[model samples]
Target: MSTTLASRASSTASRPPVTTVRVALAGCGTVGGALLDLLARHADDLTRRHALRFHVVRILARDASRPRSTAVERALLTTSVAEFLDTPADVVVEAIGGSCTADVLARGALAHGRALVTANKALLRTQGPALAAFGPRLRFEAAVGGGVPIVRLLREGLAGQGVHRVRAVLNGTTNYILSRIERGDPYAAALAAAQRAGFAEADPSRDLQGVDAADKLALLAWLAFGADPSTLEVVTEGLPRDVDAAVRGAARSGRRLRLVATAERAARGVTAHVSPALLHLDDPLAAAVDEENVIQVTSASSGTLTLRGRGAGGAATAAALLADLIHLFQPGTH
Candidate 1:
């Protein structure tokens, strides 16, 4: 019997091992649908190149009846968060953008010891420290700068280095609006164009009001400077009704109005904000146009590191999610 068992084990080892990682996706919106498409299209390459295979074991959506872009097995879809959390999965990706529900989903994932990746900046901005305290299995690269990988740079690359400041143009909707405005378009027309192109949500008040950028800046501040999100006073001022005037005025001055999100270590604590500022024509921030994002970090020794790339859209955001998934699955990284 022992000899027979040994021979069976050897036979099993001779065949290609079927290794699979289960993933629970808690949103089926644009970004989530893109991720599903990406996973299906790249599964073969991922298995061969990275020795990683992902099976989306469970999918959670607000409207389970709503049609999705990616064809998901109906048997795996669920509208109940409780059932979704109970499903067995190695990692949980939260693409839902809200504070209360996202916090609940993130906490559930961490409680089960599953790695959590999220694109919810509001939740991270306010509750990141508590979530990080729960464990080191939380990742949120898509929260700050879409597909820019800014979070990883600060967390891993500059782990030991003292990071002094982080500045970014983190909101793609506002960036698009600003870009159009710079091109001699009116604010209303630019905003309408952004909406038509799907860059801005139906109700883009959050983005235009600077709340989105403020949330991203708050999260970046906490990651780069160990600042408490609650303590960081983020002064947010969106594009005013006078934006048209400001844009024209800046053009005459050879400058442009770019919404800037900045965070710096202050004497008492960290200060962060999102507000429209006049940047010189040659300024790097001014050069970030048409949904592009640029993040600049100043460190004690590394000096300055700038990352620029597509900031939003389904493909870019989905790529960020894939990066987080790869990081979670990488050997010895967990």
Candidate 2:
């Protein structure tokens, strides 16, 4: 009579079981908060579609008292980095902005054999290869182009294809500013508009100075051509101190001024740069205005592939992070 256990399932059960990955997150700002909301809102759909679920174990934030989305549990919040690192989890999601936090999280997550995913291009541009050396469990689809899925396209979609050229408008803040300027606003007014619209950060130096696009381009080169971006010297250029005249001048010639990031594989190596250039009116890049990010890849086998999407804001970036999370954790999925 004691041999039969009521807790046991039937031997003939045929449905696939749901598997879960415990996730420890670092940062809960715009991107991180949105990520929490995304997980909560889509958890059921994910379980139905992928047969997987995420259990958030811990989160590291600068201030535990700060307000966050309703999806984030207060009991899981902590400020100590050590606690975050020590928390038992299958994956670590880092959305902290600065390079310092990114470096620390990447090193710690990889060392622990935990899958790592980040949306920090600045960190990836310099430390990606080193962190990735730990294993193939690293993913950063959110780093390159917000919700564009450019990284997945390079790594999985065109795995063996010979990619020769990659050119893109990778910064949405600068793009938004330029769009305002094209509409006859001065650089100051354009920047102010961007700030008011939440399109630009408070300190827009990195985005306005072209450093952000350079960082993204460097990462793109690493994935597309197997080049070490840290060692590659990317000749960088930003928008003119004032884009009013540049925008007006381009409109007169039926062209458009856009900050473009480019990379080309030469016989010697890969050459990459970020420059503000005038694109012909008919150019697809010219059509990407406001906060649009567009990339065109010319591959030997796949021909030319163009990918474009919303390149700014928390929602778009969070979507990318969710994709990477599923890619790494969903069993039997590539």
Candidate 3:
């Protein structure tokens, strides 16, 4: 039964329409690459459910010649920052870590009034105020808690509550090393295992020196209590370069070793510090091990809220990055 085009028009006009969300991605490292894979793998489900389609319009990396097994079309890769910025995109995601180019990209994107998202704790720790000056178009959830939605919880869940303090176990590499030590492995052996599992970086100095966790703690204080990342003084103690002593002491005392970050609202201001401490057997943090994180927020109204999850790994971090991307396009997100 064939119908005229004019007669069939009314029947086909009621179908739903779809809109695509364009994204400009910077960096193709672990988190960035996994993000691409996630977006591609879930595109159809996301579109079918949320009416959102993510299209990575451009990617900025140091060396485009570097081999990658991502789904992104080769034509989208660019080594030129200028070209990456000039490309039209609804959002710019900076996952490249470091102070130089990544900061430049973040600043460029924000200055251009583009929606900016980042999974870079180091960059944010160094220039949070500068980047945030670009307004509410910026969102960063992965920078602090890997896959845990702690940032959103602070912003939305406890929007009106007065947070008095935040205590967290923020580094997965150290946690994994300490866990291994508790299991009878030597400190060096544990460190090697963490590296083999991809939890620790090639130069794990930052993670071991407590710099990485301290940076993440500062970011959390800023979000949860409105503290300034720059002015926030974080007293840091890298988990003893060798966890053997700490592990032995904890074992003797019947405690668990965990590097904890604390931020308290004091009359002077918020005081933040990161240190490796022995946790009692029943302490909430005692359960966190190998690539796991636990963040506890004590607020005036909300009492205490605890978030626990895998705190390391590209997949976990990429999930948080993807959430930020989708929320940028979600209705009433801001």
After TM-score superposition, the amount by which residue 156's alpha carbon in candidate 3 deviates from its true location, in angstroms, is 1.4
When 2 and 3 are scored with TM-score, the better candidate is 2
lDDT of 2 by residue, 59-133 (tens): 999988887778789999999888999998888999887888779888998888788899988898889899889
Q: After superposition, how far is residue 270 of candidate 3 from its true place, in Å?
A: 1.2
lDDT of 3 by residue, 187-227 (tens): 98998999888778889999999999999999988888888
Question: What is the alpha-carbon lDDT for the whole of candidate 2?
Answer: 0.86
**Taking the tens digit of each residue's C-alpha lDDT, what string does model 1 give over 8-61?**
111144444434678999887778888898999998887666656788989998
lDDT of 2 at 121: 88
TM-score for every candidate vs. truth?
A: 0.91, 0.93, 0.92
TM-score of 2: 0.93
Which lDDT value does model 2 have at 275? 93
Give candidate 3 regions above 4 Å deviation: 1-17, 332-334
Assess each prediction's global lDDT (C-alpha) against the native. Answer: 0.83, 0.86, 0.85
Residue 311's C-alpha lDDT in candidate 3? 92
